[model samples]
Target: MTSPQPAETRTQKRSAQTATLAEIAREAGVSAPTVSKVLNGRADVAPSTRARVEELLRTHGYRRRRAESTRSPLIDLVFHELESAWAMEVIRGVENVARDAGLSVVLSESAGRLTPGRTWADQVAARRPHGVILVLSGLDESQRALLTSRSIPFVVMDPAGDPGADVPSIGATNWQGGLAATRHLVDLGHTRIGAISGPTRMMCSRARVDGYRAALETAGLPVDPGLIVTGDFHHEAGYRQGLELLRRPDRPTAVFAGNDLQALGLYEAARELGLRIPHDLSVVGFDDLPVARWVGPPLTTVRQPLMEMAEAAARLVLDLGREDRSSTATRVELATSLEVRSSTAPPREGRDVAG
Candidate 1:
């Protein structure tokens, strides 16, 4: 017989166009066979290991994958609106994860309705996507029930709460983050602190407000009802809330906002009123989103692990479709941190701290 070609050369050439198991293995710090086990949808791979492989592929952009279909990952990404910088970043994170795994995505809006059927569900069902990823604001029992009844895999990026605790959830640690923001303001020795909050329907809005109130109580100061103003958590809401607070004769010396967007608006509102930051009034905010640092007087706020949380949530939901593993809804909670910067300090010259 003629001399045979080298096995390694042949194997490498055959893999020229697609992401090979060896590539994933090296990225994941595992052997090629282990990569095969995961691609085969085997339960032998641990949850953490599976997450690592998925993350590596996602970040590295290893596409052209044609693994056996474990409920084809045609993902449906339902979002509120992509206009807001914060919302857009979350959607981007979700998309990055879905695309890297060689999956497709559908973007939908669940406006007015409690659930997505008329607005999104029916559309996603028609498309027959492998799974659904919801970035919902608030949902009632009827909406939650409808989603729960679906046999298709689903994950949620709550702008509010986990109405259906049974489904896997990934979101910023709003409560802790809020606390950190409030404490930063308090640390500067500003006690007569007020807060402008996001929509009440949002869990983050409520959690952040609660965190502010708790900080005051811990400092032995009664939470002032008059000092708290509620808003929609948008820039305009921030501007409007800022004006309301600024106009008051007994205005707050320090203010904490539910989000960075709102805080930036508040900053503008203060400037219009001839007030200087950290001098006339101190301000702190939650969600140290990308735009936070770029604004005038860099914001001191709480940072949500937005990208990492999105990836984790996406993987958890996708895993449900894999037949090789025991199908159960999983939950993963990520933490947040306080990022102090140029936007906070003590009261004006004559203003009493206790007031």
Candidate 2:
């Protein structure tokens, strides 16, 4: 007969098999009830103690076996901000998926921060939604840990930053869109082209700018740093930057506005300077928003499938929550195409194509 195993060794084996709330509490130097409160996301728990308990739970790979009845019939849709019409397209997409799934959507904003606050995480844990879909927003390590412990899956859409390799995400082919936009301008005989870019911190924005550079390089055109102006993906920033670019002594005959809104702003600036669309200045924009078509002259733009991307993100998050499904990190980028319209044209007669 084999000798009995040591008590300490036996305890270790039990822990490996199943980490209990009491064991986690003991490791965290807190009471079992306190650990439960943290797990349940009770607001009464102190921030410091809650964080400690959460860390311990994560360290032990603790996963709460939640009952089906415990989850709310809802999907959480979070955003960094809800300031633009661009958000409306995303909302419509998520809403379509959520409606078909028989689940309502809970919308939240991080109020300009890239990551939602701790309070938002706590609220999410308490509500126990089926899954979460974040648009242009990310989560902190602690927030991710909290969601993981509760087995609540999340997917990022058009991530503002590099959402790690382990995070599921959905985005558009921004680089390809940018490259196509610039190439179209070049093909139109506009050699001196300018660009208005979105915020530099955003990966999508950076990729778009990079594509623009690539297009110019391939065309044997000079990449003039002085002509690329940075904007905040807002109409005002576009208007302001457009003015600055147009005021230059050697202004570009064509410009690629990062998105449709900026393109509109650029339109306003051109009007103020007595320039005619496709005549004095040719312009291209991205995100082919509906307003792009209604504007004075239909705006030439890149079509990013915003609605489709949001729908995919929502569906992916729900799939991750299914026990039978694998929750591997998945990144999907939809294709972007250029929609040539009346906004772009050949450079004027006197403009130098080689300049």
Candidate 3:
């Protein structure tokens, strides 16, 4: 009898049983093109058909070829939450690039969480997409490892936290945006400025808040702790914080909101309290979203290049997917500019009283 093969050799032998595209297609009762679509994580595939194909692929122990040959024609776009105008801007940007590259985009949400669930990595590996782009999120160790093992590259867009020094990411100059917003209020002759900040846990939030403080200090204004409040970067939180700030007898003549959503909430609060925009209080918001211009009297806000950042991220991930990937970590931060509009003006004297 032949000597028993080593345990590692036997395991490798078992996993080496790979099936061809035609074989997988025949077994799944689908055309070769359908199998190829499923393998590429194309969004056009039907749920039932994709599931059947994926199951058949797993059963047959199918493995994709190395990146040196060819790559899947799909890109994965994962988001922390899918319910916002912000998300839409990013999606449009990525879609623009993917369309030019003749690649399909696959969208997935992390269910309102900072990171995706455990099975997310496995599902992505099974599909073998060309690349992955995560918005306001990061991958865990195992997820990173899984993608690395399969030679699939990933990029982070506006990461929520420290994405480590090695990971590539795209973001805007949030600090400069915050500084510009606050400085605009100062230039409008507002000595007292209150700020509504996003969650302290997020890097963007902290950067904006820091810039606000820096601008205040630069103008020889005292940075009052009471003038600053943290928010969850939502309309509800903005509304609640706006009520608090506007109710104060020593309220500031102007308020700088961390984002457009919060600024809109502040507008509602000011209306309920019988205050007039620019006449009684001036507000500045960040992100300069489309609604910023459509709001009543329009919003004077900092314009962040969200779509451009997304497009850059999409391009970067695709570049990383090439056979000869760059070892250096690439970090790109787009510039931010202030869009002066009708929402801001010189503060009216004696308008700091409760609104």
Candidate 4:
């Protein structure tokens, strides 16, 4: 006797036919209600049964017809991590749009992962929200496919990595911000300038660092590798790296801290070394957070409109969900500006040159 054919082979035989829920349930050796549970992302289904049903559904190219009435009155906002004032800005922006649309907001964190977990995709499908706004996060192919199969729309805001051309994304002009921050320091006659960069894995961080290099090259200054240090965009990294940079014998007369937090950390390091801001050393920073202005001497930094970017992402995702059409302008980058304050000035006398 021949062994029973594999599910794939049996499914392939009926590939020409439009697969129904009953057919999928039969193929997976489960009841119709079990298949329905899997389709609805109900947690009651067993993992093994759900996996089998999902595979059969994918194999059969099953697509559940979407009805606007079936969707929940909520907008899902996902973040890579929920730490810092940076996250608060994004939350406020998303909330503003959700409130206007008469929809409640559901927030989730990926816990530092750039891509949310598989369980999140299932939960989202079950919830069937109006749309999803992902901040500093992207979706994997499987997650994307799951959402697409369910007709759920998603938009990425300031993606930590390249979110592919087909994925809609909202971002700030990070390169321009970096350029402006460094140029401001250069214009103040600081030649030996150091830079603190955020994680290179993030496109935004890389772009900002590139802009910093461009500003130096354009102004006829050498880009010293030794003067550039990497950080995790946190105050602790800033303080730790700041100490390392400032302790160098040929320390930069001015330094561009990657973000406001790092800049604050750098301030502490400068104080410990008896180097006063804009007096013995000039400092520039990015992401002019609220604390940037409240610091002892206001921080000279680049202002990225985080809330505005978040609002744009939320709006775009809702538009996509309602229109059910791909937008012509899928990628949007908001402008960033330099916020000049008392922290930067002409490098104190001879401090302009490396000593």
Task: Point to the candidate with the largest TM-score.
Answer: 2
TM-score, prediction 4: 0.90
**Per-candidate clashes, comma-separated:** 2, 0, 0, 0
Report the lDDT of model 2 for residue 121: 94
Candidates ranked by lDDT, best first? 2, 4, 3, 1
Shift in Å, residue 79, candidate 2: 0.9
What TM-score, over all chains together, does every model reach? 0.74, 0.91, 0.80, 0.90
Question: Order of candidates by TM-score, top first?
Answer: 2, 4, 3, 1
Q: What would the per-residue lDDT of candidate 3 be over residues 47-112, giving only the tens digit for each residue?
A: 899778866665555655566446568899999888767888999999999999999999999997
Error of 1 at 341 (Å): 1.1
* Model 2 score (lDDT): 0.90
* C-alpha lDDT of all candidate models, in order: 0.70, 0.90, 0.84, 0.87
Which is the winner by TM-score between candidate 1 and candidate 4? Answer: 4
Encode model 4's per-residue lDDT on 131-224: one tens digit a residue: 9999888998778867766768889999789887668899999999999999988888888999999999999899999999999999999999
TM-score of 2: 0.91
> Taking the tens digit of each residue's C-alpha lDDT, what string does model 2 give over 1-355?
1244567864764476368888998888889999878887888988899878887877776777756678899999999999988999999999999999999999999999999998899999989999999999999988888998888989999988988766899999999999999999999998899999999989999899899999999999999999999999999998999999999988999999999999999999999999899898999999989999999899999999999999999999988888787645478899999998899999988774433
Cα lDDT tens digits for candidate 1, 1-355: 1244577865664564355558779878999877655444456788799668655543443442322443445787766655567767777777888889888777776653335554354344334456677775444443343333233567777546544444566777777777778788777777778899887877768887888888888878888898899998789999999999888887888889888888988998999999888778788887778887988788888888777777776787777655564645465558989888888876656684423
Among these predictions, the greatest lDDT belongs to 2
The true-versus-predicted C-alpha distance at residue 84 of model 2, in Å, is: 1.1
Model 2, C-alpha of 45: deviation from truth (Å): 3.2
Candidates in order: C-alpha RMSD to true structure: 15.9, 7.2, 9.6, 6.8
